[model samples]
Target chain A: MLNFAPTQEQEEIRQLAQSLAMEQVRPQGRSAEQQGDISPALMKTLTQTGLTTPFPEEYGGSGVVEAVTYTLIAEELGFGDGALAMNIIGSLMGPLTVLLAGDKSQQQHYITPFSDASRGHLQRGSLGFAERTGGYYVTEISATIRTEGEQYILNGSKRDVIHGGQSSPRVVLVRLEGTSGTGGLCALMVPLDIAGARVSLDEGKLGLIAAPSAAYTFENAPVSATCMLGQPGGSGVLRAAALYNILRAGVACGTARAALDYAMDYARGRIAFGRPIVSYQGIAFMVAEMAMKLDAARLLTWRAATSWDRGTGCETLVQEGEAAQYQAIKIAKSATIDAIQILGGAGFIQDHPAEMWMRNAAAME
Target chain B: MIDFTLSELQQAARDYAHQVALEEMRPISLECDRTEKIPDSFMWNMQRRFWAGAAGQARTQAQEGEEKQDNILSILSQEEMAWGDAALSTAIPGPGLAAPPILSQGTPEQQAKFLGPYMDGQLHWGALALTEPGIGSDVAGMSTTAVLEGDEWVLNGHKHYITNGARSDLVVTFATIDKSLGREGIRPFVVPRGTPGFVVGRIEEKMGLRASQTAELIFENCRIPKDHLLSGRESSKKAGFKAAMGTLDATRPMVGALAVGIARAAHEKTCQWVQEELPKGFSVYKRREIELELDEMGQELEMARFLVWRAAWMADRRIPNSKEASMCKAYAGGLVMKVTSAGVRISAPGENSESRQFLQKWFRDAKVFDIFEGTAQIQRLVIARRLFPEVDIP
Candidate 1:
């Protein structure tokens, strides 16, 4: 009774995403890093494939894919380039959340822009929720929202927004006035063309240079009443917490895979004392340990996502939370660090992606 | 590609266990757990349900194939017997503790004669005497010796921590038959009760599994016929160790299954207690703690069950299962320890505490699962050795 097999479609998507990442994302990722902006071109291509809109066709996106599929792509992209992968995977959360709970009209208005094949691949929107002061907890959102009639004006800013200003349409999570903590926060669709919302880029981030990290200013930005996602006043904020846990787990796994790839390749190629470094137990054991965690992480992540898709039960919720987020994050942090260690001094330089991977993992944390 | 479904055979085993657990044992489980002992009559009732009775009343007539029921007879009817206090389950004769190695390596005639008393309702205590005083993890390092004397095999050594050793009518003693071949030189011999040189030295006062007798068995010139040798192949001492260790690969999962039963008892008790017993406004935080612990324990139990089934299934299928068995044993054994520990933590010392009766005993019982059927460290060593043959196990 415990056959947990993935369908062929999931495998196909995973393969396609992995190939795309290795071919297009990894190479261009470096340039994006140098330019200090996440590549909009890459973002457009992802949206074009309906990769960003993994929801049902009724919601202006393909509903065939599960969260696991998105996670696979995210992990692969993370493996290729952490920053770019974050931007790409992080962008889909908006589309995903809307698909999950959005009303039909809102979905058509917000989702169709990017899903339209005729648009020749639009830059899918991004999610801007994390702020400057809060380290890990999402409870404190400095962005303020004031309601006047049907409209709620967003006044505060979001710092460290991945691909902040570049994505055409993005979802900004803001806390409404007269409410405290996470309970008051509501997700709103914010168009980049809005005059009051301003983006100030943070330069020379230690890692994921390809991912644009910035400080945003939303002074009296007006948002329509229909833009609010979920039940406006109730448990809307709490209901959406599972998505972050799942997707972040995917990011962790994908990047860990990439780290293993680099480390393994290096171990095989580099020789010392008339043998490959891999011949040494010191290196081989680390590689083995990495492989073990990577395997376990994959199983745990898949279990979490599959449980989500199946609507198994509440018993699975805490399990999914631990496996998908906590374990994945730990693995991502550990694997990247180990990958860098395996490479020794060569990994420390900007030329190799090892240092970059380590930094990106830090960002993931 | 492995079929993970519980097969009809396994379902039958589980069904038998379920019926016995529900009808006979469940009612008295709380009482037995509290008293930490099961009376002889209750044990006799269990013997009627399976094998290992007092007089010579075999539980059931011969089954279909009927070559001989020795193998089945020797096995501790573990599924059914585990129903009534697994600790007490280990105490009952015939199928309880002595049959594993006998079934694994016992010669055909040896099995029929030595393992016969239990099936016939003649109360025969059986013990698998393997672990030595200094050699809990390292079975190969057993200092016990068996020297050949004419047509008799004379055993001169001691076995420490033999379950049911003090009362067992038969002892399946593992000894070094030939020192030169190391592990290959070891072999098992069936030493009947009241043998001149064989003695139950001292019984240890254990923390839990309190009703089962765990004793040190000493052998001094204990003489048995050459035919008493369990391994018919007549291999070296090194081969004997391999044979004994292999039996453990099969039985370790059974040990893990026992742990599973004990943990299930704790989990089910705690779940019922938490739901019905907690008062209003009694710290939602504490309730949350119970909830989370239960959830985690449930997950661990499921995973442990999967491991146990996988190991047992591999064996039943006649597949070489040393590695899979090791994995199952390690994973399940570790999980049982964790679950029992959490059971004690959440259920102790509160008005609504559901863990009042059995958690402490289970906590103690849990450690034995990790220690007895090859320590956790040993299982890991076996896995690491198998997985990376070239690398020295750390």
Candidate 2:
């Protein structure tokens, strides 16, 4: 078929997203950034929209199976506000993991809890794929999970955990001591209130400020063997990891598209040398390059999203993830720089959304 | 419905083209590159087989066929042919270089008469002569002019760097009747090779794709019937530029597809080397690093191919794909350069670097993909215009 048009459902979702972004999401983006925390009201809005917990019908949520639609929603919310988008959608890491490879019991516990919004609660969660061990790669996650009898002992700390300080469940990547590389990697569902688990004060850092983020440390935290996701080993971890990458790519694409759209609007009316700046090749070409890069990024993300939706296999996920992430980072950086350039002096000022986008884009990679 | 799957017929075309590229094209690719001459027998034979399959598919499928993805199929076919050799795809004796414009903007009578030589059972080439020495991407700012002299039009213009120009018997020449009218004044005219004052200049020497010779064309007050005007009337300022851009919009994906070819060749070569030729003595970590790099390469090429196919599909469906067209060309142009450079870097010191040597040639060949049919910069500018249409851009 080789078609790039969205399905009817996707189109309807995107249209809904557009209106919600313009009316609800975007207006509060700046204030949220300043507050350094997502307001409960905004979280309620997102949750009510079903974006916060879209899952299968049986899972007590919207049965939005298509990753493509998820990305569209991510982009819109991200465009509205990157931090809030992350706050709302980023919390999906725990539930997504459960659905991807979790056992029935694990799904009943962790996943069923997500549909809490419709049932009157508004809890949020996070998944930690990154740890700030300078020069360490994902394969070298320092967090370790050791087996002792029927319990898996979890140690080490996770850094840059979104909603880290919040009282919500999460999944952390841990090395299964005595094993190395990806084969040794394991994902376990750790309830936020588990004993011996410590949450640090919200850490302040570069960009994406509206979303609360920090570190978590577990001191000899022991969990029943049932806490582990998927089968015995190396099952759900890979799919979860791959989904994380695709989600990041999709979010990154959101900020990039937003930046480019804002810059194009600026270029159209901003005049220089007796005409709109866009008429000049220097500016026109820059905007053009930004659009081209954005398109490429979107295509890569959508391709990855579709593949993930298929749930074909881990190999497909890894392939699409690799494709999506590279372009996401590259385009995000390029788009922000160009968006700022197109605005000239005005871009550097906080009065415009471009600077905000630049800050949000930095947190992506 | 947001599908990336190629139809069954398209898959057949792709497989057939892949075989031709591997068999008919690859064996003569190096020799043709070395000699800087078109392999006529190979080009003609492959074109015959290619078109014969295309014709057969068209005839059988139009009656009670389910669905056809013509543009994407064409794009994939271009890619497969290019994989064997970038030259073979372009140098194939056909009206490829000219058909886009005629198909996009020509009147039925004009198309029949102007395209007859190439389409009507004749082994010939037709060219779209647009780029001039002074004006490259700025088609409207051209120095070429056409002044109607009663029933005849006297055309005066100079075009260089024309593909299939030297030997093309028919050319779709873009000349402005009034430069002040800017884009509107420019129009395409069908100029036969024997038209008085129409001269073929020197053929260009190149760094790569040597088998396809580029020609410089000189038209000094060349006269042709007024009816030779491609649109059957003097173009408004917008008409000429739009027509040319329309042509690029349709053809750029094929160009992008060609880039995918070069990238595929480089990617395959690198993969083959890393898999077959790399020393088995390497450590697990080293092997993993190579494996990751290979995975990245495959991902990049496939992503680029998706963009190309999407653009082609839009064109086939008559969707306004100006942004997409430029996006694919721009992305593929940059990506092919990256892939080929990687090909050269990784294929070296493997099995005596035989593939590495060819990869170096492919690298040189890949450079022009970004330069022609609108350089990467030009494509971006076009894309920008579509993205921000509020301001009229030159």
Candidate 3:
């Protein structure tokens, strides 16, 4: 009943991703960090591989793929450069959300463009849900939305929005008139060019600089009646929350894998007392720990993915989602810290990738 | 760095052990323990049914990296196997206590002669005859003697507390080849099943590890071919001691994992008991104490697991893991004893039935882990020597 083996095609994809990572992503890791932008060429190469479209072929993408396969790809990419992988894969969440919840027409119009190259549709979307609340938990919705007879106007600010630039399409979750707090919130999809939509790109962040983590301000933004996704009331917010959980899980896996690879390589090569530092029991013990945690985190993430792949109900998967996300973050934080520890003083410097990985891990925590 | 992932080979190992545990051992587990004996028929039945299947399985698989074998999977398999019966799992026809040296330092000829027969299930019993009555932790003080006589090596030693000692078809017997060299003079020789001078002494009445026989082995001028000298070189008298100690380096962690398995059984047993006994809302006070103990036990188990996996992983990678191996043994041995005793104490008086299950046996079984395979005291000495090379004065 439990067949955890990766399919042949999935393995092929993993090998392909690994090759791409070593040949393209790894060599440019330092440059990406120094330049504050993951090479656009690499992003295009990834997009061309249909990373932007790894779903059902009918939706203009490959047929549905397993979460393990997805994780394998993320791990390989992450092993190369976590910051770059985050920038590229972080953008895929919005489209995946639409693919999950949108009507067929919406998929054809909004989702398909990101997939088919010949269509030449410039579609970019970011989830706008995190508010400037007192705490990190996104439980409270302070943004407000007023419904008019034929149209609704939204007015609120979303903080920590990734890739929140004017060039991309936007989705915002605002508290509607009838719904208050969680129940009151609804998701509205709007183009970046829409009236009263202000996009502010954050110039700085503790980590993941390649993908701008910015803020979005919607000042009485006019939205059409059909612009509302799922239900008019709270369905949209719930969908966004669900999407965030999955994306965060993916992020955690990627970052942890990266940290593990970095730590392992450092342990194997760096010499202390005339042999590989890994030869020492203290260092070897930590390496063993990293391996254990990384594997457990991956399994948890895969389990969560499998749940979603099987179309598990929202209630059944939310806890699994939380577990997967929590483990990923925990693993990433711990692995990267150990990665730095393996490198000792060298890991503390900016010239080395371990410090950056550590930063990325901390940011996730 | 060693990565402790389950290689295909290790997965094969896990699958094999898991199947044998479920199909054969698990079915007869309680009966075997209750009888305090593994019948020759059942033991032979396992040799053919389980060991034959396991030994014949194809070894070819994808090698991921330097970490060749799956230590964790092996440990997991051992845990599963122990779940069936640790004594039986330990007695399985793979390594038994004696096979590590052959696996680690044996020549191809040595492997073919010793390890091959066991792998084929042609032989079921083997014992590492190291500890003597007088020398528990000190190998240098061992009174066992083996002297070169023309082409054959004459051996005389009395090894006690040897597991499967009474039944072993092949015994890796240790003796002092040169008394002047102290610990360096020790040598291990594979004295075959029916050697004339070697005698089976009384099997000790042990607290646990009941399914596996523990006996006293006496060797009086037990003679064997010169080739029986394991890892012994014509030029070096120190060969024997290194080989004997080296065996401990590899087998200690496996022994440690046995402790882990016992502790796991105890923890799992307590958890199952809590679920069965406690009311819906009436929380038991002892359960809170048990949970707190379990928390500490879990952390200790995790740390122990890491050490075992690390040493096993290193062995798979062909790296020396003497220090890590010692650490796991030292820590986990102590942990299992504490955890098992706590398990017995946790279910004290009328609340639980120790005799009904194997908790009492587990409590009895955990004591040997620390005492055997280089005692906790020996491990500490090894750790101290490794940590501070200057500690040992000339």
Q: Which candidate has the highest lDDT of all?
A: 2
Question: In candidate 2 chain A, what residue range of length 10 has the lowest lDDT sum?
Answer: A131-140
Best by TM-score: 2
> For model 3, what is the error of residue A271's alpha carbon versus the real structure, in angstroms, after optimal superposition?
7.2
Q: Which ten residues in a row have the lowest lDDT in candidate 2 chain B?
A: B59-68
For model 1, the stretches where C-alpha displacement exceeds 4 angstroms are A4-63, A67-87, A102-122, A127-164, A172-188, A192-222, A225-244, A253-300, A313-319, A334-359, B1-37, B41-127, B145-156, B166-174, B184-198, B220-363
* Regions of candidate 2 where Cα sits further than 4 Å from its true position: A117-121, A133-146, A155-157, A175-186, A192-198, A218-220, A234-237, A272-274, B58-68, B113-122, B147-151, B193-197, B220-226, B232-238, B271-300, B342-352
Question: What's the TM-score of every candidate structure?
Answer: 0.68, 0.90, 0.61
**Full ranking by DockQ:** 2, 1, 3
Better of 1 and 3 by TM-score: 1
- Residue B226 miss distance in model 2 (angstroms): 4.6
For residues A181-258, write the lDDT of model 3, one tens digit per residue.
446656667665679978777776787666566677778888887877666553434544554655566666767777
Candidate 1 chain B weakest ten by summed lDDT? B67-76
| CA deviation > 4 Å runs, candidate 3 | A1-42, A49-52, A55-66, A100-104, A116-280, A291-328, A342-346, B1-79, B91-124, B128-151, B155-162, B172-189, B193-220, B225-271, B279-350, B353-394
Query: Where does model 2 sit among the CAPRI classes?
Result: medium
Q: What C-alpha lDDT values do all the predictions have?
A: 0.67, 0.78, 0.68
